[model samples]
Target: MIAKSNEARCTSCHAGYGWKGNDFDFTDQTGVDCLVCHEQTGTYKKFPAGAGNPAPREMVFPGNGKTYHPPDWNKVAQSVGRPTRNNCGTCHFFGGGGDGVKHGDLDSSLMKPNKMLDVHMGTDGQNFDCVRCHSTTLHNIAGRVYTTPAYEHRKSLIEDDLASKITCESCHSSSPHKEDAKANDHTDKVACQSCHVPRFARVNPTKMWWDWSQAGKKKNGKPYKVKGELERPEYDTLKGDMKWAKDVVPEYYWYNGSIEHLTVKDVIDPGKDVVINRPVGDKDDIHSRIFPFKVHRGKQPYDKVNKTLVVPHLFPKGPADADAYWKTFDWGKAIAFGMDYTGLPYSGEYDFVETSYVFPITHMVAPKDNVVACKECHAHEGGRLAKLTGFYMPGRDNFRALDTLGWIVVIGALLGVVLHGLGRVFTANGRKEQ
Candidate 1:
């Protein structure tokens, strides 16, 4: 789907080369140009100094030469993220036919964006305006925007560890792989995209919800339909079967609040009950960094599951055991059992999942151990004494438990020393009497 921006507008990145359709213009500074987005546009100028050198490819301006950099190259021009009220709203302002509030209803801005009718999601809270966070602009356009550290999605990703493909291995290798007859050894494997590369931009952070009303057997993940409208992938399933999705999975109700959808419904358990409890589009995910790119948190080689993150599970209303569905899980056990439960099937040395399916699509080099870093190491710490309880959900505090254990150990050691001292005194008295 198109962004919530003006259709005739030009892209911030591709300056002179191209624009969406035929809307791009070289001299159209009134709309968009290389300098329109790239240049550190201060008060709108004809040009800046250092006209001889050109800017770097990441931030190429229309006319200005590259900004001179120091020896370290750390001073690379930082590109702004979100649009500023002045930068974007100017075109979308009054006389231009923009929403009078800059981020409000569409009235008169240059040309209004087509996405959101109202900018902010708040219905009752303080009405947020463009100038709230983005108070300044380079070319009267703000550079970056504020974001949440964590996510706010409908589907609880705790159980969908198999779906997240942050690392190279996940997409590259399929699970339940039994290469050898004995199924004990696996040494070799390949990256995922080797075979299942994408025709379109099938990148990270996919939507994980399905509309049950629009779902069926083939669409419900029934025995991998190859040639029906109910195919799983819908457009691209495996490498050679890219055409299978249209035939296999028809009427796929996947929508990321936009088109080019990716979905997984029956979220309560991959569609046992027909009603959908989770819909990805309903999520309001906020990223600590550049969204999907910052998949891992805490450290490198982190738990890919935690990296994907999720909202607290919402119990189904219609389902019989809706309460059971909402039952708090042994979050630690869930992860530990996941690891200890299903070790990767290696081919004496090579993995069959990596060899046959997952690796080709992911284009990832299969992990040697096939073990999740966070699951194995974090067992007793936050893993053991965890909880997801109440309407205002909060995870259990395991650190406090550890501290209590530490005090117990310390007191136990002191008691042992006191007992030893008493025993020595008793022994000395007995020897003296003798």
Candidate 2:
């Protein structure tokens, strides 16, 4: 709960004011930090731990020693305009503690992308802002990830009654391929992102793994971090072992837009990998289509006896919060404190469980030339969609009886053509002799 622990390290971005506790009024318009989204001055920044409020005065942040200065209210207020890529990315790009950590497709790189990175958002291309497609009306932005339909029925804006919510069909109609009729036929079975996006984390490395079991390790009585690829942390004493990846190929799945999340009270099977959140759809589902996803795998604390995932108070309240896992480096104390605060029943026994979370890849739109090739998914060996079975694909699938019968018919047709040509030559020679 926000009333306890340092979860504001994660929640502050979603909360609009000093929402460090539950008592923070959600209905109060005075608490809204409009500058976060509207200010064009390019100076406003939310303090990482300030519960959504900008620093009241100049101060230096601890550890990183980054200096924070209060914004010039008059300058920022006068400069307020429509939100740009920078405005939306302030929180989204830095989700899950750092840039490109949560959503592999979204990052600061998109703020000023090149044509190869994103055709729409590229500074050198269409130069469209995030609000261009995600049109806002009365604070409700179009294209909410989880709430959106898996596939849009509308062909274009002409037929779309749900004008406020945008999809690929909003601009690029269902049959977008003018040249390739085969690609157009794929619309009913495959998502646009499954082909257009191709890969995510193109510009930056995204976090792929986090093992909480490896946390609390220290060197010489002091916690430290070990940097790995791209100078990113592979191991942090405060968190755990981490794995990051760049230009990652996505896992294909049948998603119908619905997602099932594992709650704290939900029972789980320790024998299997616990899916933290999964897209709800199957091959037989009419609404489902083959979509791309960044599947993040990790290990996290769970109640062994209750068979439920447990939340650990990882972030500290301040420098000397003994109950916090980051400060004390004690799992027992941290889990106990967190479980107690949440009013969840927790047995004394705890263990780490393998978990997976799925993130749909939609951003980092490549140019038409860079879209996923037909061979990538339609090949017989090692295809991208090889894992998704129960469907007949042209080049990817084969039926032994059908293949044999087709080859026989082709051979018979060739023999018939040769014999007819020879008979015609013989008849011409006999006529000449007569």
Candidate 3:
């Protein structure tokens, strides 16, 4: 199941490499094609149907009685230079098959962005690239995955260093706000991205929901799809029903830089929505901070008999693969093939259950001037952090005793000032009459 899906879905972005065979063997040096990243020629293309390899020009127009000439490999090699945002955007920006499908923070708009869109990558600002923050060394990147971070602190590079040194603090420092002490104090309880990002999918809509239970719906014996607003697919026979949103405010959560992922082996309760992945943190933890996240909700397949999530073979490598879900639209066949491929047991019973996965919003950092204001989260009611507990925000959270004491102090001060003014005015009038 994994192999078949990789051959179809994974290859969409992992293409242009020389990957071979069905298994994921890192020893297969053939898969690592340097030209995919270094080649400056836009003519370089990859075959999405193949396993991340450049498609033969003939395959594009097969048997047309025309001999299609290949691109000049020598010229492309000579033109190779540093990778640009376009090279990285080819995979990162279009993560889950389409533009703004996975990460709300990333999209094609980052390419040649202006200062209004992003402060770092803006053409009018710093104009920094991905490598600037995600610095790499010896092919090991400095950034962490969305679910986990190897390191959250800046450290010197050394052998056997497992922690990642790349972080917003590496440049911004712990005290980012120089003028505002109040803003600087928030660093301990709030993440840099929480206020800076404000919102995600600012330029494009991101996939907010996926309902696999609705898949395999066909009309007139043909797979059907419905288009939604902004040219996004509302429903598809292959995937399922989807919901998308733009300029979305992120869900706030306290994150301590740890995560728990629901693996294939974990048994889940059928009654509740299973969390596919979530950050492990709380308001009480010292290391934790209020962070912004994109909570992606979906309905995915699970083994009704075994009570565990099942990975289905959604894509097929060839036309003859009947077990492929997209090709056959048969859940039973797809689940069976998937379980057998993964060497897991199947009880022949499958059902769809609601699930959710959380993705941290770290990109699309707006300019300092455009950050979330204090009142957004510090209001008396309906604040952004109103749902967050364990800490007492000045205006948001209230204690009865503290409020009474504060009112008493204020009234006492006001009465004293009024009495002193009245006494002075009466004494002056008496002196004038005398």
Candidate 4:
């Protein structure tokens, strides 16, 4: 299943490159095709089932007595040029099965976004591409995932000089707010994206919840699907129950540029929702800063005897393969096949366990004017930063002694001014009468 998933699903994005086996051979010269991204003519095509190889010229359409011919490869290769937004977005925009399914901030709407949606990538503005921030050197991309940030300069100083640098501070210094001192002061405690990206999935909705436990449910012995809000599939026989949301307000948390990922071998507590991937940080850590995140929750299969999460082989190798879960809807056979591939023991007993993963919100940056207002985070009630601890905010937090001292000074100054005004008026009247 792992081999099929990687070769079939994963290879769809890099269809121009060639792969001989399940494992990607980095040493193989034919595996990396430069024209996939650089091809501007859009003539290059890949065979979806051929493990990243080009489609055959005389491919026959299944069940249709029709023939399809791909473009000339030599001519397509000659027209190769620099990559564009469409070339890079081909895979990223449609990640996690569909558009806006995985990352809330990235989607097909960014292809020609307006300035209001994203200042940097907007066609009316800077019109920057993914490479602007995620610069590459010899095919090594600079930026890192939110789970494992490599460019957080304030946290965990990287000792490797060869490592790529792509933090917001790399272009805009740590003190970016030159005009507003108050805004600059918050930079130490808050991330630039926390305020800049007010909300995500503005143009489209993103999947927030998935329930594999509800899978294999059939209505009248046939696989069925139900649509929910926005006409999205709420349930499917192939996948499972899902919940999607749009214009989502991100959950805030502190991050120190590190994360802990739960592997297949790790034991989990069935009593609680397992954190598949968690960012490492704390409020007291000086290197940590408040960043926005999208928390994706789901329920997946777990082994009762092994006390670990199980990896089920869902795809079938052939039409008659009984071990495939999608084909047979038999959890026992699927789990056994997966466990055997991993060389791990699996108990027949299995149950769905709650799990969650966090993805940091770093894209969909709105213009400067669209940033969060000061009152949004500092309000006395229902403030965005109210849940955050280890710091004192003047309007949000109150100290009895400090409040009393401030009131006394204000009252004393007012009383002195009133008395001086009265005395001056009385002396002026007396001088006029004399």
Which number leads on lDDT? 2
Kindly give the number of clashing pairs for every candidate.
Answer: 65, 0, 0, 0
- lDDT (0 to 1) per candidate: 0.26, 0.83, 0.79, 0.77
TM-score of each: 0.21, 0.88, 0.85, 0.81
lDDT of 4: 0.77
Give the alpha carbon lDDT tens digit for every residue of 1-434 in model 2: 12345546654577547775756676786666788889998899877777876778987866367888888989999999999999989988988878888899998899899989998889998998989988877877777656455434545776765564357877887788887778899887798999999899999899999898998888999899999967689999887999999999999999887677778889999899999888878888877878899999989888899998877787777777888887788889988888887788999789999999999888898999999999999899999999999888989999989899999999999999889888879888478778
The root-mean-square deviation over C-alpha atoms between each candidate and the true structure, in angstroms, is 25.7, 4.7, 5.4, 6.3
Task: Rank candidates by TM-score, best first.
Answer: 2, 3, 4, 1
lDDT of 4 by residue, 195-309 (tens): 9999898887888998988889998997888988766889988779999998888888888777778877899999999999887888888888899888889998999877898
lDDT of 4 at 281: 83
Question: Model 3: per-residue lDDT, tens digit, 365-389?
Answer: 8999999999999898889888887
Worst 10 residues of 2 by lDDT: 1-10
- Clash pairs, candidate 2, are none
> Which 10 residues in a row give candidate 1 its minimum summed lDDT?
351-360
Tell me which of candidates 2 and 4 scores higher on TM-score.
2
Which pairs of residues collide in model 4? Answer: none
The residue ranges of model 1 lying beyond 4 angstroms of the native Cα positions read 1-27, 31-121, 136-139, 145-419, 422-434
TM-score (C-alpha) between model 3 and the true structure: 0.85
- Model 4 lDDT, residue 136, Cα: 87
Model 1 TM-score is 0.21
Error of 2 at 306 (Å): 0.7
